[model samples]
Target: MSTNPQKVHFIAVGGAVMHNLALALAKKGYQVTGSDDEIYDPAKSRLENAGILPQNIGWDESKITDDLDAVILGMHARKDNPELLKAQEKGIKIYSFPEYVYEQSKEKQRIVIAGSHGKTSITSIILHVLKYYNRNFDYLVGAQIEGFDLMVKLTDDAPTIIIEGDEYLSSALEMKSKFLFYHPHIALFSGIAWDHFNVFPKFEDYVKAFEELAEGMPKAGAIVFDETDNMVDVICEKERADVAKLPYGAHPYEVKDGVSYLITEKGKVPLKIFGEHNMKNLHGAKKVLERLAITEDMFYEAIQTFSGAAKRLEKLGSNAHTQIYRDFAHAPSKVEATTKAGKELQPDRELIACYELHTYSSLNKDFLPHYADKLNAADKAAVFYSPHTLEIKKMPAISAEEIKKAFGREDIEVFTQKEELENYLKAQNWYESNLLLMSSGTFGGSDLNKLTEMVLALPTNKKEKAKPAAKKGSVLGKLFKKKS
Candidate 1:
């Protein structure tokens, strides 16, 4: 540690990403201190363990000292926050989360993964593969990947940094999208879909965020985009001569006996993850890795061991005939893709897909129509939203009939009460059926872990155990299988 370490203060440190960044900076030998009005578990405990938890909650103007190196602000901190006022009075440098992130990594080669969906998965894949090779790299991903301790990392030694660029507001003081601050040397635009209705009220305003990102690429920067998404394709088509445009689609793969495999030049490479969306994410990761000099063989070998990023088709528990999965999918595009992925994974099973309207866009009456038929792939579909959430968001009330009409499925179940939703799910026949729960927030504070256990223990109608399918190849055939 340096004798005079950088002194950084967090105005509001209890946020998911804010707390994680605090931990990361503390670990990097910075003198980190923070305060929040209310600190919850995980963040509270982690900060306590690090010996940096504030002795008291709420902002303190005295904590904002003249000698402070920087003040990092979280979105939770209002513009009129006491500490914020002090920092401004002292003329101390203040940075929004994304601005601070860019400041720390500006000297390194930045690879930012940006999209409406699959940003976390793509970023996780790149981090996992890079870690597998024992390469020196830093990353900032949203979800908790399996091998990583924190969701954010910053260091002085790493030559490159990978960032999961979100299209959300940076902070209260800065309303610009977080991705705008990244200014990546290499970037991937996975796809575009209208979301965050509270932030970008107009659909064109949402698209314009990506348009600005594409328009601002530095000379010699590269962007790997998904051509399958017409919106993404059209945006990338407006050419910038200095920026190289790379396009990728879903990779070739086949599923047999409840397992998905990638057809590669080295042979049939089995994967722990499935679904076409994941395959597309895998191919996108491969394209990004190619630019980093990771060959196809290396990428395939490293990817085989990666299960998935947390909450992206994450399996909770599974029985022979029943499997329970939970995903963080709230937007229309994500809902459709995740639902289709679940159905495609187990085409033979009855898919009972349940979605919770949690985001501002999902709860908006106008935005409800975009979700039309998104749940159509499910054998039985259900939608749940807490009326209380609408009250907190100050949105107008919507009825069950309105929801049903918007979905274009009269038979689809809609529940405003958590107990009613749980009861409805508990009443289902679990025999050979798969349960998929999709939400960005908890289903009105449902204990999903306990629910998963209950669903897994539910009775199935199969009288005898099913036999495992025989493999088409022998051990020698597996060894000599050719890569595509």
Candidate 2:
């Protein structure tokens, strides 16, 4: 390591990824300094503990020195940010989050998982399997997996870097999609769906970004994609002949008594996570790992203990009769998949799916039609959207009737107030039922832990008798005991 490590500054360090990047760089012996208009914990505590927390909250143009090696810009920082201007004036090289990641891992084999939905899950699975066998690798996962301490890992010695590549914009300065910069040697295209309406307004416009990513693939690079997805199939089929096309679909699995197990020649491998979507994710990950020297047997062995990526159908609380899940499923495709997965997990149990139309796209009346039949899988469905949220986003107000009609479920309940929604959920008969809460935003700032506790404490319907508990020596009973 050099005596004077390379200096880098962050314009908006409060961001989840930006703060983690700053911390990682600091741990790598870099002189890290950053500023943001507002700082929040645990980023605040982590940065302060590292002795790199800015003296003041807002940006300081004086901190931008000509000697700084680079300036890593975050999406939170605007084009007119003073710190960015100062860095530009000083000719300090600027890099977006993806750009900096690529700069660091340019020499390594970059295996990027690109998609609108399953990118995080597939990336997390690959990372979990690689780490289980002690494979030398760096990674950038979207959400925190249990074994990993941080979402992003950059190391000089790792031969490969697995990145959860999002199709969203890199930064305000860079209008291009983030995944376009990775130039992955082994790319996994999960599936494409229309999202980020503020960025790519039209479905075709959104698809074009992914098309560009596929067209730019280097020769001999392997592209593992979902053959079931028509858009992905078209993109991969049209790619240059030199780039190898590897297609995969959902792995075969069976669900019995509320548990999903993968069927193998040797035996059935029980999984902590369940769903057809997840099975596809697992298969996609397996294909990517096979190219990296992970055997089919090895992947199955390691994946059994793999729970799931955080907030991607993550279990919040579970009892004998009821389970509550919190998913980051703001988009139409994500909501549908997650809702269906919840029902599949417990076929006999009633599924009460509650969704929050919180994102800019989901709130817009023009985009409401995209959610048609999305929540039909659930036995009961409820959609909540804050009028205040619409006001904040400067979007037109959407009526409850529009939401019900858009979902193609006339009987579906819609709520504007979080309190009323919470009350409705509290009033539900949780006996032999599972609840799925799908949203990107907090349900009107509701504390989910408290909400879950209240729901769990609610009494079952007096009309129906409770079903007999699972046998003490049964597989389900054993699993529950182990979890406890």
Candidate 3:
């Protein structure tokens, strides 16, 4: 917390967020050192360039001598880490990543952006807008945004700190939610739904964590929430009565030519992305900018060029007859919003949508039903998930048949083998149709860009095979009725 360039040692430094924070600190002239049981490329190269990459992976307790100023624990480190134990025995100070974030920005006006979904997008949008307007602010984002170098930063001259607030627990030592440490002067909760079943264990308990985020704010602070999300609505209504509360519902919007238009006081603003959910995201970002005194025109100008974060509705490839997009949409609400958005954006075009059941909740049979009718808007739907993922996560096994049954779509195809799916897609008729790949993880190691390019290059209407390989006895015939 002082000007002294403290000797900070990170327990696990290979994480995307961790590496960025380490870089930010080192750039500020801090003496940063780190250890990771397994440090991969990018992070490895980054640390090495900074003269901080551990000589080898794994905890080096001998390196945790009393001379070290403090130990910043990463969530990836296990509770029994030998270096951690050594640091504890040495009576060295310890801080969770979020705790250190708070210490660095305690004197700034903190705006913590949070929710079950869309936190990264909102944070990125806000950062983009701030930069466009030439406002001075330190910030943090969850994902790798387009124009920013790192996901986190701290600067001395900035009067404000904008953060992507995750509700997950701080490192094992800090049981409180990470956002709780920020004590925001201004905040935004995109929405709340059940997630991190391994942590909260219950829907109500997960909802309660967000409630605590709102309750953590000071009386003079502000909280902006979604008025349409019943869960977020309930939580915000019950939060501390003294905090300045603002409610944001869906924006006044319209869709034309596959672009969404937000009806602003200045004029109707056209957006590259389309959906009711994204309209809500825009409204939430607008309310936050209003708190910082950003006018309607400035917000619109900056947001018009902000083409979402890396994987959120990222365009893979496109041609005259077909287009493909990959999105980080795994939660039930996110799946429904993204699938419906793609379909609505091109009502006349055939929608061939595919999703992977990659998350722990999605792979669980009980959690699969929430996806029922979520993809109904798509003309053709398929669910692809790797059975090995469940084993890797140490959860029960899940089969393709179970997923097909869970989706409740007799026509929805299922695949455990990624190659089988890829081969079928490559040989299929992609003409006059739009494809949407919805998943938080890759489809069984398939190169999304390469596959998308191959599909997009195919002629719109290829010459017909007598029986069309998709005959009743063909590989895909068993999965769907092939209405087309």
Candidate 4:
């Protein structure tokens, strides 16, 4: 840490959080310069607008000067990155993204939200309430939360910093989990489901990471966890006796006309977000607020306007009769939870759940069985995967039958091409139906807003018309085409 304005250079600054951090540091008057082999939109445009985009795309050792205050390395950068080697040779301090986040918030009360499924939503809720009440605390969330310009923020005067603690590896050179470096004074584990198989291959090893997080809490620190998860329950109970353990479950609530309201002693508090998982997330967030002395009334007041984090059951576009939602849910548990929530919110509407198998874990043959019966709630279910993705990851080719068998749903539709899937969806009558699209990646780069508009613009009166029988050699037939 330097007393004067810091000169921070990022090795791979085009990442979602990395770019945001570079911007935040620059906003704080730090001379931020960064380089990445490639930069993508949003990150690229943002960095360019901030005037911090690298003059060139590739690495330059000259950028790693001895005068630089510190070098923040993104996880995407490899150990052999030329600039990193130069910084090492110069004896300049280098920090991983998580290491840098911890370093910045070391003096403040670090509140970390860690879990596989709902951590982002939980962190967003806490930040929403904190911001509504005019609390001046810094935060590092995983998503682009509304009202917050940057995903990572660090200020000199903020007394607290809330962090979304991801369980993935810190960086290429650092095999440690990112959350392990936070040293949380107050931590919350929403729930744990095996994820990031590329990192933690075994289930036991995945669980161990969270157990380490729980055990690492300070003597007087507090931990709030989802009691519904048996794994989390056991871990919290076994934690050090000196640490305070708090658990939360789904808050009592009732849904009316597709709107959910939380039942409270004061009165019914209307919530902009819905779902059993979200209710549970709300309870977990409330527990964190309670520890911070945020009264029940204040929590309710602030939470009423909290829509949700972007892409977590976000209502992209809706018409009088139909609604479209998109969520960043590729993991089996998340897919199950999000789909069930959508159905619950609009019980009368026909639910059409479409999920994309995009992540390394979701695409792994060994991990496919975890999704069994996850989409049973939807009236119609569809799963999409890109053949190109498998090739890119160097994974063994998986057939539609394998996916169908893994889901244990013989009737579940599987599509290999984005065009066929979009066509099938377009043919549907969305008059009284709700569409839920779940994927960690875009459905093979399909534009969701345009799709939603197409759906909404469909003729509602066509519901009574019978769809034509599929041709033997049509696109729908090719979905079931066997591999040569």
Per-candidate RMSD vs. true structure? 8.5, 7.8, 5.2, 5.0
How many clashes does the backbone of model 4 have? 0
Candidate 3 segments exceeding 4 Å error: 1-3, 462-484
Candidate of highest TM-score: 4
Q: Rate the local accuracy (lDDT) of all candidates.
A: 0.90, 0.88, 0.82, 0.90
Positional deviation of 384 in candidate 3, in angstroms?
1.8
Candidate 1 weakest ten by summed lDDT: 475-484
Weakest 10 consecutive residues of candidate 2 by summed lDDT: 468-477
Model 3, 168-286: lDDT tens digits are 88897887788888889888989986777677777778887887787778878888999888888887877575788899988899888778888877788888767788888888998
Per-residue lDDT of candidate 1, residues 1-484 (tens digit): 5556899999899988898999999998999999899999888999999989999998889999988999999988899999999999999999998999999998999999999999999999999999999999988999899989999999987999999999999988899999999999998999998889889998799999999999988899998999999999999877897899999999999998778999987799999998899999999999999999999999989999999999999999998888899999999889999999898888888889999999889998877877766787888889999999999999999998877766767778999988998898888888888999999988999999999988888776654323422213333223323320
- Scanning candidate 4 in windows of ten residues, the lowest lDDT window is 468-477
Candidate 1, superposed: residue stretches over 4 Å from native: 462-484
Q: Candidate 2 lDDT, tens digit per residue, 302-374?
A: 9999999888999989887789999999998899999999999988888889999999889988777778778
| Model 4 lDDT per residue over 1-484, tens place | 3368999999999999999999999988899999999999999999999999998998998999889989999899999999999999999999999999888887899999999889999999999999988898999999999999999889988999999999999887788899999999999999988899988998889999999999888988999999999889999877486899998999999999999999999889999999999999999999999988899999999999999999999998998889999999988889989999999998878888999999999999977877776887887889999999999999999998888777756667899888989899988888888999999888999998898888899887535523322212323223323320
* C-alpha lDDT (0 to 100) for residue 385 of candidate 3: 84
Candidate 2 C-alpha error for residue 67, in Å: 2.2
Question: Which segments of model 2 are wrong by more than 4 Å?
Answer: 1-3, 462-484
